[model samples]
Target: MAVVAVSAGIMPDGYGSDRCWLNYDRGFIWSFLGPVCCILGINAVLFIIILILLRTALSQMQHGPAHDKLIKMVVFKTLVQSVIVGLPWILGFFTRSSQALDVVFHVLNSQQGTFIFLLHCVLNEEVRKQFRSCCRRMTNKE
Candidate 1:
């Protein structure tokens, strides 16, 4: 992809085309920096919420049974989903288009948006699991 981007002359001269898509033209700082930082900030917030929910579940679980297996499964699933969704944008970043960098920026933005949605779904599922467990415990107590 970097080769393609270089051959297409999208990257300025002297820059190593071997760099990862995200690293390319990153020196501009202001243009790509702001958006990347914003996306990461949002992701961090969502990640924190996921962690809190997971911790709550762990705290609620009975010591008789280890929930490590379930926690690992959820974490693995989330990681796989994230990698699958992110692969395309990573590829796109390396490949340069004839369109201006603005187009690339928009494409990256859209990819980030999609990732955010997927992240939300992942977090929502964790929250739902916690809710279900709470309801089950309440019903059992009654």
Candidate 2:
């Protein structure tokens, strides 16, 4: 994919040929820095803060299996969300360095929603219950 993009003239050669907001010199902030910092960095920081808050709250709240399970789920979801929503943008910085990395970045960056769906739907007990219920209903109907 990276090679195809490069061959098709889709990937900029870092030579400023296309000349747009993405041309490092012309609009570096608008194209890269702004989105990367705002979206990726902030999401990471926010998730960290959420985990800290959850930890403190858990220490204060009554200790029980339910509380622990909820906290575990929240922490897992937060970590997963942060990584999927944020970290891949960091790859944008290195996309210019290697074709392999560039293709990896594009693949990971584009699959954020798919990753979330797998996390929340396939792995989530609540969603699985709903799926089972729907299946049971269809079976009964037949």
Candidate 3:
């Protein structure tokens, strides 16, 4: 799609094109359609993964507490991933480049890492227990 847009002169070159900046230009809307479609495609894939996870979780719901926790974690991760990946792209469609938006974009970009760390390390009971044990060992050494 991007290659076609570029070849058709609808999209600007990455380095040499003035349209690389966040201003409107001729064919800009058509050019942006490529990335817009890409973003939408990504969201669609994520949605499918979320649906699969939900279905699997539902089927395992009557199994036990483990499945309950897994389901909750999967849902939380899916929501976080969507916001982290989708929000900045959606906002970019509205705003031009700016200090505030740049900061926000960076923050949103990092949220996936933070959320994953929290989900796997902080929220997991087993990881928390290991972390606490390591802390105790360190403190005892001190």
Model 2 score (lDDT): 0.74
Instruction: Residues 12-118, candidate 2: write the lDDT tens digits.
Output: 54334463334565443344455457766677677778888989988898889998898888788888877787667787677777888888888998999999999
lDDT scores of the candidates, listed in order = 0.58, 0.74, 0.68
The most accurate candidate by lDDT is 2
Reference-based lDDT, residue 132, model 2: 99
TM-score of each: 0.36, 0.74, 0.65
State each model's C-alpha RMSD to the native: 12.1, 7.4, 4.1
Q: Pick the candidate with the highest TM-score.
A: 2
Model 3 residue 21 lDDT score: 44
Tens digit per residue, CA lDDT, model 3, 71-109: 777777677667666787666654555768866766766
Q: What are the clashing pairs of model 3?
A: none
Off by over 4 Å in 3: 1-23, 29-33, 97-103, 110-112
Residue 142 deviation, candidate 1, in Å? 44
Give candidate 2 misplaced runs (Cα > 4 Å).
Answer: 1-21, 25-31
